[model samples]
Target: MAGDEAIRLVSYDPSWPERFEEERVALEGAIGEWVVGGIHHVGSTAVPGMEAKPIIDILVGVRDLDEARACFDPLAELDYLYAPYLPEQMRWFCKPDPAHRTHHLHLVPVNSQRYRDELAFRDKLRSDPGLAQRYVALKRELAAGHPSDREAYTDGKSTFISRCL
Candidate 1:
């Protein structure tokens, strides 16, 4: 919860996948049936051996936004705070607390471009160490330059991510 907007990147931890699994089970119990596709671990943390921020990024593929919207209450009951941060394409939710988020849930349509792109990017990074390393380097540079600007830090990586996709 401390330094919520501050950018902090750390070396990869083998525990990230396990943490994702734990969250996945909890999430499945909460709203798994409502989802069209299964949940996925995306982002830098999903890439093994890649340095990243210590937050787990989860992609929940739902049939549509309506189904995703319906998950707000159930997810909240499980400590996932719902936010209409990206209503156009996805429903955003953060776990534990927004101020010190441990997980981020992005609910998008299973067949949407965003969904495919995210998975593709993650898969590419997982398969290619050089690509993953470059991404890690970019993240580190962005974190150092915009330590207090979360939006800028994310925006800075958009280009690289798009290319990777």
Candidate 2:
């Protein structure tokens, strides 16, 4: 893997929302209306005043699995790598940065629990600074030792996130 693709935690940038907006608009233009139910700024970057890894995580909700099939392959043309094991009810993809990604794109059924939990968590974090601060501290500590292994990074977060769900 290129060192540029190295995943690590970093202080949050205030520009995450604007970056998401730009990507959202571009994704909407690229995918069109039929496949995209709703696109949102999700994950740690979506919360205001939170420290994050500078990745603009996006949640693209689709109406149905069939609709996703109709469009999933084309998304690959834009570097969206399908990750079928992400969860049963949703389709997940990682759009690697040709220039080193600062983002992760998630595709999900319009109303899945995963989607609900993500939104709920994001909202919860935004509404509760103490919790968000704890999460931020956890992430910083975890990333300090494991900068590039994705599984380790996620595992570090599961305990807290699982409780939130």
Candidate 3:
């Protein structure tokens, strides 16, 4: 699906915290120690008072993508589908087989644009409650449609997200 329909927002669920911990343990064991610089649970789900997509987004930083590449075997063995957003651009991995895999692992090279952008966007949302509320409102509106229509939803929010970025 080229990741277009992956953004499905869900009402804030208290269970998300437990889900994150469960995921962190599984990922740390499956992907090995050094493959991740620091595995962070970012996105709205990570924050305490924000609505978010049901999916748990995990940010895995590495010395380089090569270090992350080594985890492909272990990760896939655990049912994660590895796909790069853009091979020439950067390397990251996720469970295309979402149910089978537990988390969205973005293995970004330290200090890269993509990494910075992810952090910036997430931090902006965290620090500014007004923007977070706006995001929540937009997501609620978007959620009325097909939750799986990732592309349509992302396209719709591009402007709002860009401003936050």
Candidate 1 Cα outliers beyond 4 Å, as residue runs: 1-3
lDDT by residue (tens digit), candidate 1, 56-144: 99999999997677888899898888777768899988877767878999999988999999999999998998998888888889988
lDDT of 3 at 33: 74
The TM-score between candidate 2 and the true structure equals 0.85
Checking candidate 1 for backbone clashes, the offending pairs are none
Compared with the true structure, model 1 gives a TM-score of 0.95
Sorted by TM-score (best first), the order is: 1, 2, 3
Error of 3 at 103 (Å): 2.6
Show the colliding residue pairs in model 3: 4-150, 4-151, 5-150
Best by TM-score: 1
Worst 10 residues of 1 by lDDT: 1-10
State the weakest 10-residue window (summed lDDT) of model 3. Answer: 1-10
Between candidates 2 and 3, which one is better according to TM-score?
2
Compose the digit string of candidate 3's lDDT tens values, residues 1-165.
543444556677888788878877887887657554567777778776888777778877777776667878887776677775666545656666643334677777766777777778888887888989998898878776746665577677778888777
Task: Answer with 1 or 2, whichever has the higher lDDT.
Answer: 1
Error of 2 at 109 (Å): 0.7
